[model samples]
Target: MARIKALVFDVFGTLVDWRTSIARESEQALTPLGIAVDWLAFADAWRDQYQPAMEEVRAGRIPFCKLDCLHRRNLDVVLADLGLDQLNEATRQQLNLAWHRLDAWPDVSAGLHALRQHYRLAPCSNGNISLMVDLARRNDFPWDAILGAEVARDYKPKPTVYLSAADAFDLRPDEVMMVAAHSSDLAAAAEAGLRTAFIARPDEYGPGLGESAATVPVDVSAGSLIALAQALSTANTPP
Candidate 1:
């Protein structure tokens, strides 16, 4: 493995339990309006909206909207689909902020703290900047920098976003390592010449990630962030 100077994490699934957090928050927010939807299923559908929503822009079906707008667009669609039409502005705004209340995955804080001692650690999520900042503060996510789709004004898997991250740190792609739970995410980083470490978010699909943990080319594969950190701490370039 090559030395890694920076660790850019895919925030949503890798470090944070976005699905659970969004679900829980949505239930609370919806309760006031006497709207009780299947929060878990709602969360799943909401997350499902993430990819195709971005693809809309990627394919030029929609203009370049930020992730926040994209998320809201999807949220509105799902809300209507679920027959939820009653919500005050205040309640609706809070619901939209569900992403900000994301709970960190187990071992996230401890591992990131350990790794941060030896490397630069930040978020490189498809989330917007304000969303990432809010999440960091809410969960005490201790990022040296908060990067998101806002930086590139576009989403990842777009090569441009990944390279934008390299540009942000004034480093070559090879000097940066992207840690993600999703193989597709890591593939983009790796193809950009960035190193990749896959920390298995085995429950990302809510329970048992359907596929086995044996996905390929993941330079370093770990069962948890803390364990991944232990490995990275020792794998740093010798001073």
Candidate 2:
């Protein structure tokens, strides 16, 4: 096997607690406007629109746009669904930025710090560059660069997104490992000829609603980023 020279990550559920973070952010943003809804359900409802919106771009029904634009569009749909479409443009815009303020998982910072000692690191998230930058700054993520859907002009599961990230680092696909909580994502990366690692985020959707393990086989599987770092470190160590 080619030595892994870089590690790219899936940001939303893999590194950050998007469900709880979005719930908290939504309540904070909407409560002041007298909106009363189950915040977690609201978060889920908003997220449910994510894939379909991306599918529009992937299927060529729409031009490729940044995730921020897709997020804003999804936010409008969510607001309308909840009868909160009366919100002013400025308020909606501010609320749409909630994705940027998501909190990272507890193990992320230190684990990434450890991994950085051995390999180049960057986020291969579907999130736009600005969104990734905001999350990185807010969480102190040590990314070498922001390379993902925005950089590739395409979303994940598309071969270009993974290959583009590898190209950005000037590494062969086999020299890069795609770490994610979603098996589907890892499967896609493996199909694109990148190494794959899986870390389950059991509460990503809610209590026990997320994946407990990779449904597909992977090169490495661990419960947390710290453990993943340890596993990779050991595997790459000299005899």
Candidate 3:
């Protein structure tokens, strides 16, 4: 096979600990407003609406909109559901930007920096470019470019999201590896002819709720991004 020319990562779970970060942010931002609930459960409930909200755009039921707009809508829905719909615009917007402040996993920066020595790196997430940029800057993730839902104007599992990243580098699908924690994302990327890597994120959904490993076949699978970088380095080394 040709050497991997680029690695496109799934940002939310693979690189960042969104569950804890979102929950913490929610508690920090909303508790002072006298809206105290199970913040973790609130985070999960908000996240559960993510894909379905995007599916509206993907299905042409709604026009193309950035993930931030979708996030705002989802946040409102979650707030309404939790009986906390009385927030002002400023408060709502502040809560929405919590997605931008998600903390990266411990291995992410070092792993991406190491992997960048060998191959180009970018986030192939459902997150829009602004969201990606905020997260990247906040977490010190060194991405060569931003690619994903915003670039393709379509969410993942959509062939365009994966293929567009490869296209951005002027490379064939097989030359670009899609690195994600979700088996479904890898499967979709594989279907689009991109190489696939899965990093198990056991705490992505909060402890045991997250995926422990890929259930589908992928070109590479690792416990974390740093391990994947080491494994890839070894694979590329000559005996």
lDDT of candidate 2 over 126-234, digit per residue (tens): 9999999999999999999999999999998899999999999999999999999999999999999999999989999988999999999899999999999899878
- The whole-model lDDT of each prediction reads 0.81, 0.94, 0.92
Q: Estimate each model's TM-score.
A: 0.93, 0.98, 0.98
Q: How does residue 162 of candidate 1 score in lDDT?
A: 82
Order of candidate numbers by TM-score, starting with the best: 2, 3, 1
- Report the number of clashing residue pairs per model: 0, 0, 0
Misplaced by over 4 Å in model 3 are none
Off by over 4 Å in 1: 210-214, 236-239
Q: Which model scores highest in lDDT?
A: 2
What is the Cα-based lDDT of residue 43 in candidate 1? Answer: 94
Which of 1 and 2 is the better model by lDDT? 2
The ten-residue window of minimal lDDT in model 1 covers 209-218
Tell me how candidate 1 scores on lDDT.
0.81
Q: Which portions of model 2 miss their true places by more than 4 Å? A: none
